[model samples]
Target: MKKSYPFLVLVFFSSCWSYSQSIATSPYSLYGLGSLYESNFGLTAALGTAGIALPSEEFINNKNAASLVNIPANNFFFEIGGTGIQSSFEDNVRKENRNNFQFSHMAFAFPITARSAFNLSLMPYSSSSFKISGLKIPIIDGNNEYYYLNVIGTGGLNNLDLSYAYRLNNKLSLALSASVLFGNTTDERTYSISSSTTSIDKKVNYSGIRPILSSQYKMTSSLTFGLNVKSPTRINANKVQSVTVENGSGSSFLETDKKSDIDDFYLPLDIGVGISKSFKNKFNVTLDYEKSYWDSTNQSDMYASFSDQEKFSFGLSYQKAKTARNYFNRIKYAMGAHYDTGYLEIDNKKIDDKNLSVGVSLPLDHLSSSLYISYTYGSKGQITNSLIQENYHKLTLNLNLDGIWFVRKKLE
Candidate 1:
């Protein structure tokens, strides 16, 4: 335990810095918020699960506001969940992992004036937590701990959005929402050399803001269309520095010394369409197509740069009327798929990966309780570039809980 104290201190105290941004630069800064939520089953069912324009009817599906319109009137909603990632790199050289938990959304919807309903929600717009570790065996020395590198980071971007929906005719509904995003990130790392009591420690801190617009249109009782446009955003990370030591006698610290431009670049653009059909109100099948505009993002101050091609996806669900104990609600089974051309480019070659997942959801009475569990597997195919060709597989588990509190109204 005493030997590991220095490494822990290095990881915790190093993340204090800032950077600049600009519009002419790449909008890749948006990727820093965190990995989007993708269920193992959802990856196989749709395009990254990012283009959901409408909400679900049984509950607030987290995909679109349109799904909220189907919710029972005069009821509130809330949701919370967490995800874990266990990843591996090529040749077993690099490994990244993390376990994270957060609240997804909290909102209440009720009739305002006429046929219109308004919902105000506090939810996580984005989030990310990942770690990387590598070990090197000395060719000359036989030390058990020759070389080690450890990187750790944790933070999230969130937003408060206002949504409204109006029932036009019987078979058609339209909805719109506006959201603002705010979040920050902190990263720390330690590198040790072989045959010497020397090491280097680094730290970084960053923050930013973004605005988003989303909407959905229902064409028929069994079909719906979704659309979302996220404007350009900029993240500024400043006060970067590096610390080096030799023989544990003296310490030297140096500032990163790089100046940044603070401007906004359009984040990736996303579009998708979905169709669902119900059989005797017992079971339903849903299919969708999504396109992500990674080309719009040209640069990033926090991560590597690349051209991410558009991706594709699909999904299916089975629901039944079943009862459980006080904690259990209705049970639902779901499966999905997702594919994307990675955003980073090496040697002008595009990187890509695919995902597969399955999940189960439980609806708790009017209180709105739910639980979903999924796992994902991804591999980066060889690109045209000549660099460290690496591929990885990630396992993710997500758990969620949602409920509402009424100050004056009667319970359902």
Candidate 2:
């Protein structure tokens, strides 16, 4: 217990430090708030971010808060994770590569009573970091005439969630969570013509609060069902701007340090459902589907249009019963796939994503502690005259630690 508290504190501070240095290298994050970060806690990432129906008997499940009620009594769980990605982006005429690393999430959960539990997590909600240089845009009405545009963007929103779950009966559990999102983004754009260049730099600040409701029902000893809903929210926004121009003449500041209220960003309502089934004692399967009503948000982007989005995830795992001598019996192997019909439409084309993952969890000790390692190969967008396709390989690593509390030492 003594060591556990200090470890938790260390993880908390470490996440804060990582947040300050985080950067997303995906070019597709240029729209809206940026790319929505998937906080795949524990081995969920290895399972293609499925498992909304899995219980928390042995490990933490951040997807469905109601699973917290399944946490073992007198147990304390903590998890932290990170990802490294190598990505390639290509279009009709250009191809480039990039590599980077980012922190995933930090979370901890503990039992409040025999039938209730509490959890807290820190994670990135979205990322807007992107870089584009000298993109040519043709004039709307002029023939064979074009203008050059350059853009650099950074920063994104972060989410801090507090969740509570209570078991209503032997087979049913309910949970509620409060998610606070706050962040700022900086966008710098430069436009150039024959002999003149103009620059506009602005920082957008955003803040919002969202509520999530979740439930889990154990239909049988080996089967479970889950559902979750996230209410729509309005994120207030403000911007600070500075503009400058440079040509053959000396550079001059047209505006500096101007601040004003901007349009609020509206989030779409999201809902998901999932099921899990175990085969014998060796194999488990989970399937999930989710939908987001982005069109209802009525938000508009200069380069894209919002539409309804759908996501699907499927996973399977194999584990053997514990054995005294064979260490291989203690490890678990998993594989899964995920697909998303993206919400953004560029030039009437759907910007979609699909991925496959494989992972293994190694036992750290006789207890529930484990080391999770996962590898994912994924792609998003498509090569078109106006769109760039992205392919990426991601490696994820996390440590999940379990501790026994309020128990006397037997050896001493």
- Once fitted onto the true fold, the runs of candidate 2 whose alpha carbons sit more than 4 angstroms away are 1-23, 143-146, 247-251, 322-325, 408-412
Return the TM-score for candidate 1, rounded to 2 decimals.
Answer: 0.64
User: Which pairs of residues collide in model 2?
Assistant: none
Model 1 agreement with the true structure over 173-271: per-residue lDDT tens digits? 556766555555455556667533333333334455444444556666555666545545555544344455554555654434334333443356555
How do the predictions measure up, each by TM-score?
0.64, 0.91
- Tens-digit lDDT track of model 2 for 1-412: 0111111111111111212244456666777898888888778888988988987576789889999998788999999989888877766555676777878999999999999999999999988866556666667645788888777778999999999999999999999999999999999898998889999999999999999999999999999999999999999999999999999978999999899999999989999999999998789999999999998998778667789999999999988864445789889899999999998887777889999999998998887789999999999988766577889999999889999887788895
> lDDT per model, in order?
0.47, 0.84
TM-score of 2: 0.91
Candidate 1: Cα lDDT at 363 = 58
Model 1 ranges with Cα > 4 A deviation: 1-55, 92-162, 166-174, 187-209, 236-266, 300-304, 320-330, 366-368, 375-412
